[model samples]
Target: MARKKHTEMSFLDHLEELRWLLIRSTIAIIIVAGACYFIDDYIFNTIIFGPKDPNFITYRFFCGVTHFFGVDDTYACATEFKFIIQNTEVGGQFSIYLWMLVTAGFILGFPYILWEFWRFISPALYEKERKKAALFIIVSSILFFIGVLFGYFVVVPLSINFFATFQASSDIVNQFTIDSYISMIKTSLIASGLVFEMPIIIYFLTKLGLVTPVFLRKYRRAAIVIILILAAIVTPPDIPSQIIVSIPMLILYEASIIISALVVKKQEQNG
Candidate 1:
Protein backbone atom coordinates (compact mmCIF):
# COMPACT_ATOMS: atom_id res chain seq x y z
CA MET A 1 0.00 0.00 0.00
CA ALA A 2 1.20 3.48 -0.86
CA ARG A 3 1.34 6.23 1.72
CA LYS A 4 -0.92 9.20 1.13
CA LYS A 5 0.78 12.55 0.66
CA HIS A 6 -0.16 15.10 3.32
CA THR A 7 0.48 18.31 1.47
CA GLU A 8 -2.63 20.02 2.77
CA MET A 9 -2.61 19.51 6.52
CA SER A 10 -3.85 22.43 8.60
CA PHE A 11 -1.95 23.67 11.68
CA LEU A 12 -4.44 21.95 14.00
CA ASP A 13 -4.19 18.76 11.98
CA HIS A 14 -0.42 18.76 12.39
CA LEU A 15 -0.83 19.27 16.13
CA GLU A 16 -3.27 16.40 16.35
CA GLU A 17 -0.91 14.14 14.46
CA LEU A 18 1.94 15.14 16.74
CA ARG A 19 -0.19 14.39 19.79
CA TRP A 20 -0.91 10.88 18.60
CA LEU A 21 2.70 10.29 17.71
CA LEU A 22 3.78 11.27 21.22
CA ILE A 23 1.04 9.21 22.78
CA ARG A 24 2.04 6.10 20.86
CA SER A 25 5.70 6.60 21.62
CA THR A 26 4.98 7.05 25.31
CA ILE A 27 2.84 3.92 25.36
CA ALA A 28 5.61 1.91 23.76
CA ILE A 29 8.10 3.14 26.33
CA ILE A 30 5.78 2.37 29.22
CA ILE A 31 5.19 -1.17 27.97
CA VAL A 32 8.91 -1.86 27.77
CA ALA A 33 9.45 -0.20 31.12
CA GLY A 34 6.90 -2.50 32.70
CA ALA A 35 8.98 -5.46 31.61
CA CYS A 36 12.15 -3.79 32.84
CA TYR A 37 10.66 -3.40 36.30
CA PHE A 38 10.60 -7.16 36.80
CA ILE A 39 14.32 -7.50 36.10
CA ASP A 40 15.38 -4.41 37.98
CA ASP A 41 17.53 -6.36 40.42
CA TYR A 42 19.69 -7.97 37.76
CA ILE A 43 19.86 -4.81 35.73
CA PHE A 44 20.88 -2.67 38.66
CA ASN A 45 23.31 -5.08 40.29
CA THR A 46 24.93 -6.85 37.36
CA ILE A 47 24.77 -4.25 34.60
CA ILE A 48 24.58 -0.81 36.16
CA PHE A 49 27.13 -1.50 38.88
CA GLY A 50 29.46 -3.58 36.75
CA PRO A 51 31.93 -0.80 36.13
CA LYS A 52 32.57 -0.33 39.83
CA ASP A 53 34.47 -3.58 39.87
CA PRO A 54 38.21 -3.27 39.28
CA ASN A 55 38.16 -6.28 36.97
CA PHE A 56 35.70 -4.74 34.55
CA ILE A 57 36.42 -5.36 30.85
CA THR A 58 37.33 -1.75 30.25
CA TYR A 59 39.85 -1.75 33.11
CA ARG A 60 41.41 -4.97 31.89
CA PHE A 61 41.71 -3.57 28.39
CA PHE A 62 43.42 -0.43 29.67
CA CYS A 63 45.70 -2.51 31.86
CA GLY A 64 46.67 -4.59 28.85
CA VAL A 65 47.41 -1.44 26.86
CA THR A 66 49.67 -0.14 29.62
CA HIS A 67 51.48 -3.48 29.79
CA PHE A 68 52.10 -3.38 26.01
CA PHE A 69 53.64 0.08 26.35
CA GLY A 70 55.93 -1.12 29.18
CA VAL A 71 54.72 1.77 31.31
CA ASP A 72 54.62 1.81 35.11
CA ASP A 73 51.38 0.46 36.52
CA THR A 74 50.50 3.80 38.11
CA TYR A 75 48.05 5.00 35.49
CA ALA A 76 45.53 2.89 33.62
CA CYS A 77 47.27 -0.30 34.66
CA ALA A 78 46.59 0.22 38.37
CA THR A 79 43.25 -1.36 39.17
CA GLU A 80 43.04 -1.53 42.95
CA PHE A 81 40.20 0.86 43.76
CA LYS A 82 37.59 0.43 46.49
CA PHE A 83 34.44 2.41 47.09
CA ILE A 84 31.16 1.89 48.86
CA ILE A 85 27.70 2.84 47.52
CA GLN A 86 24.90 3.73 49.94
CA ASN A 87 21.32 4.91 49.83
CA THR A 88 20.61 7.86 52.12
CA GLU A 89 16.94 8.64 51.59
CA VAL A 90 14.21 6.12 52.50
CA GLY A 91 12.86 5.81 48.97
CA GLY A 92 16.16 6.30 47.18
CA GLN A 93 16.58 2.68 46.17
CA PHE A 94 13.00 2.41 44.95
CA SER A 95 13.30 5.65 43.03
CA ILE A 96 16.50 4.44 41.42
CA TYR A 97 14.79 1.20 40.42
CA LEU A 98 11.88 2.98 38.79
CA TRP A 99 14.07 5.50 36.99
CA MET A 100 16.40 2.79 35.73
CA LEU A 101 13.42 0.92 34.32
CA VAL A 102 12.28 4.02 32.53
CA THR A 103 15.77 4.62 31.15
CA ALA A 104 16.03 1.05 29.96
CA GLY A 105 12.62 1.33 28.36
CA PHE A 106 13.70 4.42 26.47
CA ILE A 107 16.83 2.72 25.25
CA LEU A 108 15.12 -0.48 24.22
CA GLY A 109 12.20 1.26 22.54
CA PHE A 110 14.34 3.89 20.79
CA PRO A 111 13.85 2.39 17.34
CA TYR A 112 10.06 2.36 17.73
CA ILE A 113 10.13 5.94 18.94
CA LEU A 114 12.14 6.89 15.91
CA TRP A 115 9.69 5.05 13.69
CA GLU A 116 6.76 6.99 15.08
CA PHE A 117 8.65 10.26 14.73
CA TRP A 118 9.56 9.39 11.14
CA ARG A 119 5.95 8.52 10.39
CA PHE A 120 4.84 11.86 11.73
CA ILE A 121 7.31 13.76 9.58
CA SER A 122 7.26 11.59 6.45
CA PRO A 123 4.13 13.18 5.01
CA ALA A 124 6.01 16.46 4.82
CA LEU A 125 8.80 14.88 2.77
CA TYR A 126 8.86 13.68 -0.83
CA GLU A 127 7.75 10.14 -1.69
CA LYS A 128 11.32 9.06 -2.34
CA GLU A 129 12.39 10.46 1.00
CA ARG A 130 9.59 8.62 2.82
CA LYS A 131 11.10 5.29 1.74
CA LYS A 132 14.26 5.93 3.74
CA ALA A 133 12.55 5.38 7.11
CA ALA A 134 14.05 1.93 7.66
CA LEU A 135 17.54 3.15 6.92
CA PHE A 136 17.04 6.12 9.22
CA ILE A 137 15.86 4.01 12.15
CA ILE A 138 18.54 1.35 11.67
CA VAL A 139 21.44 3.77 11.41
CA SER A 140 20.24 5.98 14.22
CA SER A 141 19.63 3.03 16.55
CA ILE A 142 23.03 1.54 15.76
CA LEU A 143 24.76 4.81 16.51
CA PHE A 144 22.79 5.26 19.72
CA PHE A 145 23.61 1.76 20.98
CA ILE A 146 27.26 2.21 20.10
CA GLY A 147 27.30 5.42 22.07
CA VAL A 148 25.59 3.71 25.01
CA LEU A 149 28.11 0.89 24.98
CA PHE A 150 31.01 3.32 24.75
CA GLY A 151 29.67 5.18 27.73
CA TYR A 152 29.11 2.01 29.74
CA PHE A 153 32.35 0.22 28.84
CA VAL A 154 34.69 3.19 28.61
CA VAL A 155 33.47 6.43 30.16
CA VAL A 156 31.65 4.96 33.15
CA PRO A 157 34.45 2.59 34.09
CA LEU A 158 37.15 5.21 33.77
CA SER A 159 35.12 7.65 35.83
CA ILE A 160 34.38 5.13 38.56
CA ASN A 161 38.02 4.04 38.70
CA PHE A 162 39.31 7.60 38.86
CA PHE A 163 36.96 8.73 41.59
CA ALA A 164 37.30 5.54 43.58
CA THR A 165 41.08 5.74 43.59
CA PHE A 166 41.52 9.45 44.00
CA GLN A 167 41.65 10.47 47.66
CA ALA A 168 42.26 13.79 49.40
CA SER A 169 43.48 12.03 52.53
CA SER A 170 43.59 8.63 54.20
CA ASP A 171 41.01 9.70 56.74
CA ILE A 172 38.23 10.10 54.22
CA VAL A 173 36.37 7.12 52.81
CA ASN A 174 34.41 7.35 49.57
CA GLN A 175 30.80 6.46 50.27
CA PHE A 176 28.81 7.48 47.24
CA THR A 177 25.05 7.63 47.51
CA ILE A 178 22.96 5.45 45.22
CA ASP A 179 21.43 8.54 43.70
CA SER A 180 24.81 9.98 42.77
CA TYR A 181 26.10 6.74 41.27
CA ILE A 182 22.98 6.13 39.22
CA SER A 183 22.87 9.76 38.16
CA MET A 184 26.40 9.55 36.78
CA ILE A 185 25.60 6.40 34.84
CA LYS A 186 22.37 7.86 33.49
CA THR A 187 24.04 11.08 32.44
CA SER A 188 26.90 9.27 30.75
CA LEU A 189 24.66 6.91 28.81
CA ILE A 190 22.02 9.42 27.78
CA ALA A 191 24.45 12.20 26.93
CA SER A 192 26.59 9.95 24.75
CA GLY A 193 23.52 8.45 23.13
CA LEU A 194 22.28 11.90 22.14
CA VAL A 195 25.74 13.06 21.11
CA PHE A 196 26.00 10.16 18.67
CA GLU A 197 22.95 11.54 16.85
CA MET A 198 25.16 14.23 15.36
CA PRO A 199 24.91 12.91 11.81
CA ILE A 200 21.11 12.76 11.87
CA ILE A 201 20.94 16.23 13.39
CA ILE A 202 23.34 17.53 10.74
CA TYR A 203 21.27 15.99 7.97
CA PHE A 204 18.13 17.81 9.08
CA LEU A 205 20.01 21.08 9.64
CA THR A 206 21.52 20.82 6.17
CA LYS A 207 18.13 20.03 4.66
CA LEU A 208 16.76 23.19 6.20
CA GLY A 209 19.69 25.18 4.74
CA LEU A 210 20.62 26.22 8.26
CA VAL A 211 24.03 24.55 8.11
CA THR A 212 26.61 23.65 5.46
CA PRO A 213 29.72 21.50 5.24
CA VAL A 214 31.73 24.61 4.50
CA PHE A 215 30.41 26.23 7.62
CA LEU A 216 31.34 23.17 9.67
CA ARG A 217 34.82 23.05 8.19
CA LYS A 218 35.33 26.77 8.75
CA TYR A 219 34.63 26.38 12.47
CA ARG A 220 36.51 23.11 12.83
CA ARG A 221 38.98 24.61 15.32
CA ALA A 222 36.26 26.13 17.42
CA ALA A 223 34.38 22.88 17.25
CA ILE A 224 37.42 21.00 18.52
CA VAL A 225 37.68 23.40 21.44
CA ILE A 226 34.04 22.89 22.20
CA ILE A 227 34.39 19.13 21.89
CA LEU A 228 37.30 19.16 24.28
CA ILE A 229 35.26 21.20 26.74
CA LEU A 230 32.34 18.82 26.41
CA ALA A 231 34.65 15.85 26.87
CA ALA A 232 36.10 17.43 29.96
CA ILE A 233 32.63 17.99 31.29
CA VAL A 234 31.44 14.45 30.65
CA THR A 235 34.44 12.31 31.51
CA PRO A 236 36.94 12.33 34.35
CA PRO A 237 39.06 15.44 34.73
CA ASP A 238 42.27 13.69 33.69
CA ILE A 239 43.76 14.31 30.25
CA PRO A 240 43.62 10.64 29.17
CA SER A 241 39.91 10.31 29.94
CA GLN A 242 39.20 13.61 28.22
CA ILE A 243 41.20 12.52 25.17
CA ILE A 244 39.42 9.18 25.02
CA VAL A 245 36.00 10.86 25.02
CA SER A 246 37.00 13.70 22.68
CA ILE A 247 38.39 11.41 19.97
CA PRO A 248 35.01 9.80 19.22
CA MET A 249 33.20 13.16 19.30
CA LEU A 250 35.73 14.60 16.85
CA ILE A 251 35.20 11.63 14.58
CA LEU A 252 31.45 12.17 14.79
CA TYR A 253 31.86 15.84 13.89
CA GLU A 254 34.02 14.97 10.87
CA ALA A 255 31.50 12.35 9.83
CA SER A 256 28.70 14.92 10.18
CA ILE A 257 30.57 17.22 7.80
CA ILE A 258 30.79 14.48 5.19
CA ILE A 259 27.13 13.65 5.62
CA SER A 260 26.15 17.29 5.28
CA ALA A 261 28.19 17.64 2.09
CA LEU A 262 26.57 14.56 0.61
CA VAL A 263 23.12 15.82 1.51
CA VAL A 264 23.83 19.17 -0.14
CA LYS A 265 25.08 17.48 -3.29
CA LYS A 266 22.02 15.26 -3.45
CA GLN A 267 19.74 18.23 -2.90
CA GLU A 268 21.45 20.17 -5.68
CA GLN A 269 21.09 17.24 -8.07
CA ASN A 270 17.42 16.81 -7.23
CA GLY A 271 16.75 20.53 -7.64
Candidate 2:
Protein backbone atom coordinates (compact mmCIF):
# COMPACT_ATOMS: atom_id res chain seq x y z
CA MET A 1 0.00 0.00 0.00
CA ALA A 2 1.24 3.45 -0.83
CA ARG A 3 1.62 5.91 1.99
CA LYS A 4 -0.68 8.89 1.87
CA LYS A 5 0.87 12.32 1.49
CA HIS A 6 1.60 14.02 4.81
CA THR A 7 -1.13 16.58 4.11
CA GLU A 8 -3.67 13.86 3.35
CA MET A 9 -2.95 11.75 6.41
CA SER A 10 -5.14 12.45 9.40
CA PHE A 11 -3.75 12.62 12.91
CA LEU A 12 -5.10 9.14 13.67
CA ASP A 13 -3.46 7.87 10.52
CA HIS A 14 -0.08 9.09 11.75
CA LEU A 15 -0.66 7.53 15.13
CA GLU A 16 -1.57 4.23 13.49
CA GLU A 17 1.65 4.31 11.50
CA LEU A 18 3.66 5.00 14.66
CA ARG A 19 1.92 2.11 16.37
CA TRP A 20 3.01 -0.34 13.69
CA LEU A 21 6.54 1.02 13.77
CA LEU A 22 6.86 0.33 17.47
CA ILE A 23 5.31 -3.09 17.10
CA ARG A 24 7.71 -4.11 14.35
CA SER A 25 10.74 -2.77 16.22
CA THR A 26 9.75 -4.59 19.39
CA ILE A 27 9.29 -7.87 17.53
CA ALA A 28 12.70 -7.49 15.95
CA ILE A 29 14.27 -6.97 19.36
CA ILE A 30 12.47 -9.93 20.83
CA ILE A 31 13.60 -12.20 18.01
CA VAL A 32 17.20 -11.18 18.36
CA ALA A 33 16.99 -11.57 22.15
CA GLY A 34 15.50 -15.04 21.78
CA ALA A 35 18.46 -16.07 19.65
CA CYS A 36 20.75 -14.82 22.41
CA TYR A 37 19.33 -17.38 24.83
CA PHE A 38 21.27 -20.16 23.15
CA ILE A 39 24.55 -18.45 23.91
CA ASP A 40 23.72 -17.32 27.42
CA ASP A 41 26.87 -18.88 28.84
CA TYR A 42 29.14 -17.06 26.44
CA ILE A 43 27.25 -13.83 26.99
CA PHE A 44 27.58 -14.03 30.76
CA ASN A 45 30.96 -15.67 31.27
CA THR A 46 32.92 -14.29 28.35
CA ILE A 47 31.47 -10.98 27.24
CA ILE A 48 29.80 -9.59 30.38
CA PHE A 49 32.24 -10.93 32.97
CA GLY A 50 35.33 -10.65 30.79
CA PRO A 51 36.18 -7.15 32.03
CA LYS A 52 36.59 -8.34 35.59
CA ASP A 53 39.39 -10.71 34.63
CA PRO A 54 42.90 -9.32 35.08
CA ASN A 55 43.86 -10.76 31.70
CA PHE A 56 41.09 -8.98 29.79
CA ILE A 57 42.41 -7.55 26.55
CA THR A 58 41.78 -3.92 27.48
CA TYR A 59 43.61 -4.29 30.77
CA ARG A 60 46.45 -6.17 29.13
CA PHE A 61 46.84 -3.46 26.50
CA PHE A 62 46.96 -0.71 29.13
CA CYS A 63 49.34 -2.76 31.24
CA GLY A 64 51.63 -3.20 28.25
CA VAL A 65 51.56 0.52 27.56
CA THR A 66 52.46 1.33 31.17
CA HIS A 67 55.22 -1.30 31.12
CA PHE A 68 56.68 0.11 27.90
CA PHE A 69 56.69 3.55 29.53
CA GLY A 70 58.54 2.17 32.59
CA VAL A 71 55.75 2.80 35.09
CA ASP A 72 56.22 0.91 38.38
CA ASP A 73 53.61 -0.69 40.68
CA THR A 74 50.61 0.68 38.81
CA TYR A 75 47.13 -0.77 39.26
CA ALA A 76 47.49 -1.91 35.65
CA CYS A 77 49.85 -4.67 36.83
CA ALA A 78 47.52 -5.98 39.53
CA THR A 79 46.64 -9.69 39.19
CA GLU A 80 43.33 -9.50 41.05
CA PHE A 81 40.54 -7.18 42.12
CA LYS A 82 39.86 -6.76 45.80
CA PHE A 83 36.10 -6.83 45.40
CA ILE A 84 33.60 -9.62 44.85
CA ILE A 85 30.29 -9.25 42.98
CA GLN A 86 27.31 -10.42 45.02
CA ASN A 87 23.63 -11.14 44.33
CA THR A 88 21.71 -10.40 47.49
CA GLU A 89 18.25 -10.84 45.97
CA VAL A 90 17.19 -14.39 45.21
CA GLY A 91 16.17 -13.46 41.66
CA GLY A 92 18.89 -10.90 41.11
CA GLN A 93 20.96 -12.93 38.70
CA PHE A 94 17.89 -14.01 36.77
CA SER A 95 16.68 -10.43 36.54
CA ILE A 96 20.10 -9.32 35.30
CA TYR A 97 20.11 -12.10 32.74
CA LEU A 98 16.77 -10.94 31.30
CA TRP A 99 17.86 -7.31 31.24
CA MET A 100 21.13 -8.19 29.48
CA LEU A 101 19.24 -10.14 26.87
CA VAL A 102 17.19 -7.05 26.09
CA THR A 103 20.30 -4.87 25.97
CA ALA A 104 22.14 -7.23 23.65
CA GLY A 105 19.04 -7.57 21.50
CA PHE A 106 18.73 -3.81 21.15
CA ILE A 107 22.39 -3.43 20.22
CA LEU A 108 22.40 -6.19 17.63
CA GLY A 109 19.04 -5.18 16.25
CA PHE A 110 19.87 -1.49 16.01
CA PRO A 111 20.08 -1.34 12.22
CA TYR A 112 16.63 -2.78 11.79
CA ILE A 113 15.35 -0.44 14.45
CA LEU A 114 16.78 2.46 12.46
CA TRP A 115 15.10 1.17 9.33
CA GLU A 116 11.75 1.07 11.08
CA PHE A 117 12.27 4.57 12.43
CA TRP A 118 13.20 5.87 9.00
CA ARG A 119 10.10 4.32 7.53
CA PHE A 120 8.04 6.18 10.06
CA ILE A 121 9.56 9.58 9.29
CA SER A 122 10.26 9.23 5.58
CA PRO A 123 6.69 10.03 4.55
CA ALA A 124 7.19 13.56 5.81
CA LEU A 125 10.56 14.01 4.06
CA TYR A 126 11.14 15.13 0.52
CA GLU A 127 11.83 12.37 -1.99
CA LYS A 128 15.48 13.42 -2.23
CA GLU A 129 15.90 13.25 1.51
CA ARG A 130 14.06 9.93 1.75
CA LYS A 131 16.49 8.42 -0.73
CA LYS A 132 19.29 8.84 1.80
CA ALA A 133 17.72 6.40 4.24
CA ALA A 134 20.25 3.66 3.63
CA LEU A 135 23.18 5.99 4.07
CA PHE A 136 21.73 7.42 7.25
CA ILE A 137 21.12 3.99 8.76
CA ILE A 138 24.57 2.70 7.80
CA VAL A 139 26.46 5.67 9.12
CA SER A 140 24.41 5.89 12.28
CA SER A 141 24.79 2.18 13.02
CA ILE A 142 28.54 2.29 12.44
CA LEU A 143 28.95 5.23 14.78
CA PHE A 144 26.77 3.61 17.41
CA PHE A 145 28.72 0.33 17.34
CA ILE A 146 32.04 2.15 17.53
CA GLY A 147 30.82 4.07 20.56
CA VAL A 148 29.63 0.85 22.20
CA LEU A 149 33.06 -0.71 21.71
CA PHE A 150 34.75 2.37 23.11
CA GLY A 151 32.49 2.30 26.14
CA TYR A 152 33.11 -1.39 26.68
CA PHE A 153 36.86 -1.37 26.16
CA VAL A 154 37.71 2.05 27.60
CA VAL A 155 35.03 3.40 29.89
CA VAL A 156 33.80 0.21 31.54
CA PRO A 157 37.23 -1.16 32.33
CA LEU A 158 38.59 2.08 33.70
CA SER A 159 35.51 2.48 35.88
CA ILE A 160 35.59 -1.09 37.15
CA ASN A 161 39.32 -0.96 37.75
CA PHE A 162 39.12 2.27 39.71
CA PHE A 163 36.20 1.15 41.84
CA ALA A 164 37.77 -2.24 42.44
CA THR A 165 41.00 -0.75 43.69
CA PHE A 166 39.91 2.45 45.39
CA GLN A 167 39.47 2.27 49.18
CA ALA A 168 38.75 4.88 51.85
CA SER A 169 40.30 2.61 54.46
CA SER A 170 41.75 -0.88 54.80
CA ASP A 171 38.89 -1.97 57.04
CA ILE A 172 36.21 -1.23 54.44
CA VAL A 173 35.91 -4.12 52.01
CA ASN A 174 34.35 -3.53 48.62
CA GLN A 175 31.43 -5.67 47.52
CA PHE A 176 29.42 -4.71 44.46
CA THR A 177 25.90 -5.90 43.73
CA ILE A 178 25.36 -7.58 40.39
CA ASP A 179 22.63 -5.08 39.62
CA SER A 180 24.96 -2.15 40.17
CA TYR A 181 27.68 -3.68 38.04
CA ILE A 182 25.30 -4.39 35.16
CA SER A 183 23.77 -0.94 35.46
CA MET A 184 27.16 0.71 35.04
CA ILE A 185 27.98 -1.42 32.03
CA LYS A 186 24.61 -0.79 30.36
CA THR A 187 24.68 2.97 31.01
CA SER A 188 28.20 3.32 29.65
CA LEU A 189 27.51 1.38 26.46
CA ILE A 190 24.14 3.00 25.65
CA ALA A 191 25.20 6.52 26.61
CA SER A 192 28.32 6.38 24.49
CA GLY A 193 26.40 4.98 21.55
CA LEU A 194 23.85 7.81 21.73
CA VAL A 195 26.57 10.45 22.13
CA PHE A 196 28.16 9.30 18.89
CA GLU A 197 25.00 10.22 16.98
CA MET A 198 25.74 13.94 17.34
CA PRO A 199 26.51 14.38 13.66
CA ILE A 200 23.34 12.70 12.55
CA ILE A 201 21.40 14.76 15.05
CA ILE A 202 23.01 18.02 13.94
CA TYR A 203 22.30 17.24 10.29
CA PHE A 204 18.58 16.96 10.94
CA LEU A 205 18.59 20.00 13.18
CA THR A 206 20.27 21.90 10.38
CA LYS A 207 17.68 20.71 7.88
CA LEU A 208 15.00 22.02 10.20
CA GLY A 209 16.84 25.39 10.52
CA LEU A 210 17.27 24.77 14.23
CA VAL A 211 21.07 24.86 14.14
CA THR A 212 23.78 26.49 12.03
CA PRO A 213 27.55 26.31 11.65
CA VAL A 214 27.98 29.74 13.20
CA PHE A 215 25.86 28.78 16.16
CA LEU A 216 27.91 25.64 16.71
CA ARG A 217 31.16 27.58 16.48
CA LYS A 218 29.98 30.31 18.82
CA TYR A 219 29.11 27.70 21.43
CA ARG A 220 32.16 25.54 20.94
CA ARG A 221 33.66 26.52 24.28
CA ALA A 222 30.48 25.73 26.15
CA ALA A 223 30.17 22.40 24.34
CA ILE A 224 33.68 21.50 25.42
CA VAL A 225 32.83 22.09 29.06
CA ILE A 226 29.66 19.98 28.73
CA ILE A 227 31.57 17.24 26.96
CA LEU A 228 34.20 17.16 29.68
CA ILE A 229 31.50 16.97 32.32
CA LEU A 230 29.84 14.07 30.50
CA ALA A 231 33.20 12.33 30.13
CA ALA A 232 33.88 12.72 33.82
CA ILE A 233 30.48 11.28 34.65
CA VAL A 234 30.93 8.19 32.48
CA THR A 235 34.62 7.53 33.02
CA PRO A 236 36.66 7.07 36.16
CA PRO A 237 37.51 10.24 38.07
CA ASP A 238 40.94 10.44 36.51
CA ILE A 239 42.35 12.96 34.06
CA PRO A 240 43.72 10.37 31.61
CA SER A 241 40.48 8.40 31.40
CA GLN A 242 38.44 11.58 30.97
CA ILE A 243 40.83 12.73 28.24
CA ILE A 244 40.46 9.42 26.44
CA VAL A 245 36.67 9.83 26.34
CA SER A 246 36.70 13.55 25.57
CA ILE A 247 38.83 13.34 22.42
CA PRO A 248 36.27 11.45 20.33
CA MET A 249 33.36 13.63 21.49
CA LEU A 250 35.36 16.77 20.65
CA ILE A 251 35.98 15.36 17.19
CA LEU A 252 32.30 14.58 16.77
CA TYR A 253 31.35 18.13 17.73
CA GLU A 254 33.69 19.51 15.08
CA ALA A 255 32.23 17.12 12.55
CA SER A 256 28.71 18.25 13.48
CA ILE A 257 29.70 21.83 12.65
CA ILE A 258 30.96 20.76 9.25
CA ILE A 259 27.78 18.81 8.62
CA SER A 260 25.63 21.74 9.61
CA ALA A 261 27.56 23.98 7.25
CA LEU A 262 27.07 21.63 4.34
CA VAL A 263 23.36 21.36 5.04
CA VAL A 264 22.95 25.16 5.13
CA LYS A 265 24.92 25.52 1.88
CA LYS A 266 22.66 22.98 0.21
CA GLN A 267 19.54 24.77 1.41
CA GLU A 268 20.88 28.06 0.08
CA GLN A 269 21.60 26.49 -3.31
CA ASN A 270 18.06 25.10 -3.49
CA GLY A 271 16.61 28.50 -2.64
TM-score of 2: 0.95
| Candidate 2 Cα errors over 4 Å, as ranges | 1-7
Candidate 1 per-residue lDDT over residues 78-107, each given as its tens digit = 556767899999999888888899899999
Misplaced by over 4 Å in model 1 are 1-4
List model 2 lDDT by residue over 129-167, tens digit each: 888999999999999999999999989999988889889
Model 1: lDDT of residue 31: 96
Model 2 pairs in collision = none
Q: Please report the candidate that would top lDDT against the real structure.
A: 2
Provide the global lDDT of candidate 1 against the true structure: 0.90
Model 1 / residue 230 / CA error / Å: 0.5
